[model samples]
Target: MNLRQTINSVQAHEKELALFNIDADERIDEELRSFFRTQNVRITTAQTASGCPEEIAVLAAGETVLAVVEVETLRELVDGAGAQSRRLGVTDTAYSEVLSHLKETTFTSCETADMLYASREIEDRARRNGTGTVHAGFQRCSTIVSQQAIYEDLSRTGVSVHAYGVPDVTPPELAGGQVHAVGGEIADLWFVVYDGGSEESQKSALLAEEDSAGRFYGFWTYDSAIVDSVCQYLTETYLGGNGQFPQFRA
Candidate 1:
């Protein structure tokens, strides 16, 4: 199969697998359902059989329910990101809080966690918890998140990283042209589109710090069209990749 087809197949399998694997409770908590609904997260009730491995909730951003959120009830919440704390799978982020709030939801254990996985790649506590063997495929969290530096955050669930550290690679003075936020929202706006060679675009030799999502940050745009155009340039030119796209002498 082609790259696009393979990606789609993997995505489809993941969605089906997530739903099929969940062991839902008899009834969902009304308050918990209401809270998620308010945040635009679609929640549904599941019918789990008696011998199911673990319980989980289908969480969807759009029509696709690509994730499962296991509910957890807590008498007290403990939180930390240190080595010891992370190994225990302890987290108090927004994702975990929603799970904690639900009274009827049963938490998803590591053994049962497949779809909506915590970003922690290491399984230091696996020998004790007996969840599963430490999978080699986990992404080791990065320490420095500076521009061009990459890291996986426990708070986020997808390949996309929305969190970005301050920009140190690119200076503001080199910005080709500024894009300010519109609708009366105005401030210093800038962007750097990777042109395959460097973060600096040939059009505007200015360097915008490349963020975790592979986009240049540290700028705002008043005109949506300008930002869209810049991003489109990045996608069409860079996203295709160097190998897939054959280079030619101009």
Candidate 2:
């Protein structure tokens, strides 16, 4: 399946996050709620007369409660320790927490900033592992100009990198990185898929479509099977028939 269809396959499942005893300022409260909504997770709040020491957040799929974490921890995620942390780095920790409990789940609408944070997280993981096949789609090659360095660094680590986009700009040199210039449905997608080179535990992917000017609707997944499928489709569709690169390995 294509990227959009792959996302739709998992988007069928629904999940929710429930907050209990969340006594926080309206601004903070709304921010917390907005954070989960970006991931396509619904939020429900309830307060108890006997106030607890900390606010609790629970993730559930239908009647099954999947994960439980402190609401304050989530607040810390969005607000960060200071100005620098608030930028985007701290949110990686928060995304880890959310991903730990929710895998193969769809995130409804992710802003460019949100997608940027997540894409970096997945790329960082592949860099640290130093082994894996990374596929990044920029929609337009001009977009790849800004990320040229990032992919170059990733390729240096022995992670095979493939950059895809419309042939709108000259392809930048990316060391071990391979640039795929083409046109079709891929022009509307923004994605990053890493096939955790020899390890299933390290597999991860971020797939989204630029539905509007700056907003993308999609999901980030750590599921190896799902990740493999995405990588397979990209490899076959873009690299197939052409002996440019070998097939993607899961």
The numbered model that scores best in TM-score is 2
**Candidate 1 positional error at 42, Å:** 1.8
lDDT of each: 0.26, 0.75
Q: After best superposition, candidate 2 residue 112: deviation in angstroms?
A: 2.4
Candidate 2 Cα errors over 4 Å, as ranges: 18-32, 45-58, 67-99, 103-108, 241-250
lDDT of 2 by residue, 1-250 (tens): 8878987877766678778877555455567565555454677777777876358888887888887888777776776544444332223454566645553444667767768887998999899999979999998888888899999999999998999878777767667888877777768889999999877888988888876576778888877888989988877777773535442221
* Candidate 1 lDDT, 60-153, residue by residue in tens: 4346544454543211222222333222123345555343222111112122122112222221122223221111111111212221122222
User: Which residue window of length 10 is worst by lDDT in model 2?
Assistant: 83-92
The count of backbone overlaps in candidate 1 is 7
User: Backbone collision count in every prediction?
Assistant: 7, 0
Candidate 1 stretches with Cα past 4 Å from truth are 1-28, 60-66, 73-250
Error of 2 at 46 (Å): 8.0
